[model samples]
Target: MKNNILFKQQLFLVLTAIFFTSCLSNVDEEVIIEEPVSEITFNVHVKPIIDNNCTQCHSTAGGTSPNLETYAGVSANAARIKAEVESKRMPIGGTLTDEEIQAISIWVDAGSLNN
Candidate 1:
């Protein structure tokens, strides 16, 4: 019957509206996805790089350049350190990997945090 078909179409429209409304209502307002920032600490990240590559010649005992035994010492020459490392000038006959240099650069840029 025509009436039966009309009723079925109306019911289908109502169901679709209800379905869409429910779906829209279920959406969250603010979805904050906090991405963890990998912090570059002096003792944890920067110290290891200096110890591995720079301390051999930049230490207090038999070092040729400035002392890098402490955070203060390293921070004092942070600019020079960045320049030399970037240019591959220091470490004498050795070399620092791109990752290592980047870590150092990041540390310096982050105010050379002692952590």
Candidate 2:
């Protein structure tokens, strides 16, 4: 009877260890989640506006301030860019429509993607 009890105890311990180990392994496993980032096309929406309004003064050759030729350049100056757009300080000689200003603001807020 003592031998049977000892065998049962040993089996219980082994099963408990296996159950605990499996639980621990599952706890350590990693779960991945994929999120899609919205893409903003630069040429279609952003470029024409800049070329028509800003390039005259913001270009490298013009030397009005800084050149806004690329995405990095624009992103680096996002705060100033947004402020200028919001306040209608850009396209210096003329005013931008509310929709145009809002579009520029949205683009900057959306991570200023080059796409």
Candidate 3:
């Protein structure tokens, strides 16, 4: 009877380990799909992101430098904007979602078009 109990306990431990190993082994890594750069334009995608996350600090009426209130300002500073947001360094008090950051990156990659 003692041997039977010991064998059952060992079996339970082995089963638990196998269960966890199988579950964890099936976990998938996150994949980020890049949108066509042409589909991601300045007005349609990038502006709203800037408007929501950046304009509070970088607006025309605000005290912040490098105002993002216009296309020209944003397009001109596209590289800096992409770098800062990608590093999660800008916006100071706010956050940009992965999707928003991706949009900004693609926009910059597409030559920071005014469209």
Candidate 4:
């Protein structure tokens, strides 16, 4: 009788442990995942800066020749834009702080999402 009780107790303990572990594993799997940072919309965030600063000289009718008004335009010229931004050559004659430059660079590096 005692042996039977011990065996049952052990079995119950093992089952309880398994139940708790399975619950924990499910909880872990339920954790919400975040979207990739690169997927963020550049049109909404980064374009405003370009519009305010570079567009005057770089737009369709501006001195810079090409217009960065649309995604195709911007993506096509991403390399040049990246070079100028990386070299701090853009926003010519105007000053943008390091933080602003970093933001622009990050947006570009993030695949320039159109949103």
Judged by whole-model lDDT over C-alpha atoms, candidate 2 comes out at: 0.72
User: Which lDDT tens digits does candidate 2 get at residues 53-114?
Assistant: 78778878778776876666666876787799887777789777765666666677777777
lDDT of each: 0.83, 0.72, 0.91, 0.73
Question: Which scores greater on lDDT, model 1 or model 2?
Answer: 1
What is the clash tally of candidate 3? Answer: 0
Which of the predicted structures, 3 or 4, would earn the higher lDDT when compared with the native? 3
Predicted structure 3: lDDT? 0.91
Positional deviation of residue 50's Cα in model 2 after best superposition, in angstroms: 1.2
Q: What ranking of all candidate models by lDDT puts the best one first? A: 3, 1, 4, 2
Model number with the top lDDT: 3
lDDT of 4 at 42: 70
Count the clashes in each prediction: 0, 0, 0, 0
| lDDT (C-alpha) at residue 105 in model 2 | 68
Model 4, position 107: C-alpha lDDT score: 67
Predictions: Cα RMSD each: 10.5, 12.4, 5.1, 10.4
Error (Å) of candidate 1 at residue 66 is: 0.4
lDDT of 3 at 53: 82
